[model samples]
Target: MQIIELNQLTKTYGGARGITDLSFTVEHGEIFGFIGPNGAGKSTTIRTMLGLIYPTSGSAKIFGKDCIAHGPEIKMEIGYLPSEVFYYDNMRVKDLLHYSASFYKKDCSKRIKELAEIMELDLSKKMDDLSLGNKKKVGIVQGLLHKPKLIILDEPTSGLDPLMQQRFFELLEEENRKGATILFSSHILSEVQRLCNRVAIIKEGRLMALEKISALKENTYKKFKLETLTKVDASSFAIPGVTEWTADERTISFLFKGNINDVMKKIAEMELINIWVEEPDLEEIFMHYYVKEDGSRHEHVSA
Candidate 1:
């Protein structure tokens, strides 16, 4: 039931880096999160998958078919919403949607109307007349109008307000329940944390980590900040689980991943004015991955 498969999926732009030896898969009915900062090759990998761009090396398959050789067949089941949407400005929303639907055999008018209503998109408005948010709504409607089997969303919530985003997430969840496989690409950690069952983290055009959300959180790192009455030697806190710390006069903070008892005992020996120990959020963990120069932390997943 692997709907999508990537094997040594490398893409390079001349001498610049794109994705290097990337490999992963999206199984049926799974909400797979593809995460990384901008320029981390999220878009590159996606474009290649969609066959909009050819890879310098490696290959991708969708629905068990080669993406390049059988792109048109594979694309019939995919609904893709890019971060930035572009359309014929002269066409009304209704006209453009109808045009897009023409590519498929079945009638998408009724589904288009339903999606527009759910997204609150004004079908009467010309593409040029809509705001960025409204245009994004149009993109959502167009992408889902055909009731595609696989949804590929790249930074799909960019221009939406909080309420709209909530609604959109609900819509995607509904689609998932209806047996649609989704590949959600975004830099927003919280959104990925909330919706994705499994995530593939990429950095500098390389896969960094791939794990279930539960596993990632279970291995959660703790953030600690302490204000001491006096300065202490940095090496004093160099325990097995403690990462490097940032020190400023009497204040210091670092991330810890193991036995809290050991850290508590060490802190008990210190003269502190105040201290704060809390669970690090995904953003903090994301920064941890970003700063890692070595790829040793990546957990390679087989396709």
Candidate 2:
């Protein structure tokens, strides 16, 4: 089942920046990655889907219902952790969580305790006294306490240490295994690569690509690096598949996606000292979308 949907969803703030013509979907039981650098409309798209902000054009749907029209009902099944967290300064962590849990129909007390222990969050600490990381931990605990069906996270790991981040990922995986759907948005490519089943790449307020994580990494660019015995012309490496090409005297490098033999044959024509051919990771593949000249988009997956 489609858990969330966006169709030509656009939001503009007059002269200010916002998302445009964005479209995608998250499946019922998959972890979907929404990735882009800052100002790329990651947050705007999310806020629109959550009904925090109305779109200037088009629409979004959650649980097969129009988002804005059914926000209250839709939100009941959602667990959301914003990029930044703010709370009453005087309240203790436990108090804030309890207040948040009050909105739900079920009693989240026991679940809150379990999550707090797993996250190693100190419930007695006052919100004003907690560090940024601790504050983020509270957000995590608050979001998951009700055992929501759909989890929406925006840049959720900013303040966590490596160990904490690992724990959080494990926790998310556990939830996913138990049938929670996740929509994770972040600029951190590595984390997204490790956790998500599929990803929707956005740039400059536009939807760029959507594909399964494995398929994307498999069919995308391959990294090529060679050190020639002598000076080489950068133009010599400008094959049809080559992109983000660069050369400095005896060193040359670029990303290629076509038949390996074609590129190898070109390299064979040159005198080289050493060479390295490697599969490009998600991060490098993502860079190609950002820096490409023709502005061509990758294969789009149907929402």
Provide the RMSD of all predictions against the true structure, rounded to 1 decimal.
4.0, 4.1
Q: Worst ten-residue run, lDDT, model 2?
A: 294-303
lDDT of 1 at 275: 97
Once fitted onto the true fold, the runs of candidate 1 whose alpha carbons sit more than 4 angstroms away are: 221-303
What is the C-alpha lDDT profile of model 2 across 1-303, one tens digit per residue?
Answer: 999989999999999879888888788999999987777899999999999999999999999999999999999999999999999999999999999999997889999999999999999999999999999999999999999999999999999999999999999999999999999998877788899999998877887788788865565677889999998887656679887788888888898987889998999999889999876654576667445477655434543
Per-candidate TM-scores read 0.82, 0.81
Candidate-wise lDDT, in order: 0.89, 0.88
Best by the TM-score measure: 1
- Give candidate 2 misplaced runs (Cα > 4 Å): 219-303
Give candidate 2's error at residue 128 in angstroms: 1.4
Model 2 RMSD in Å is 4.1
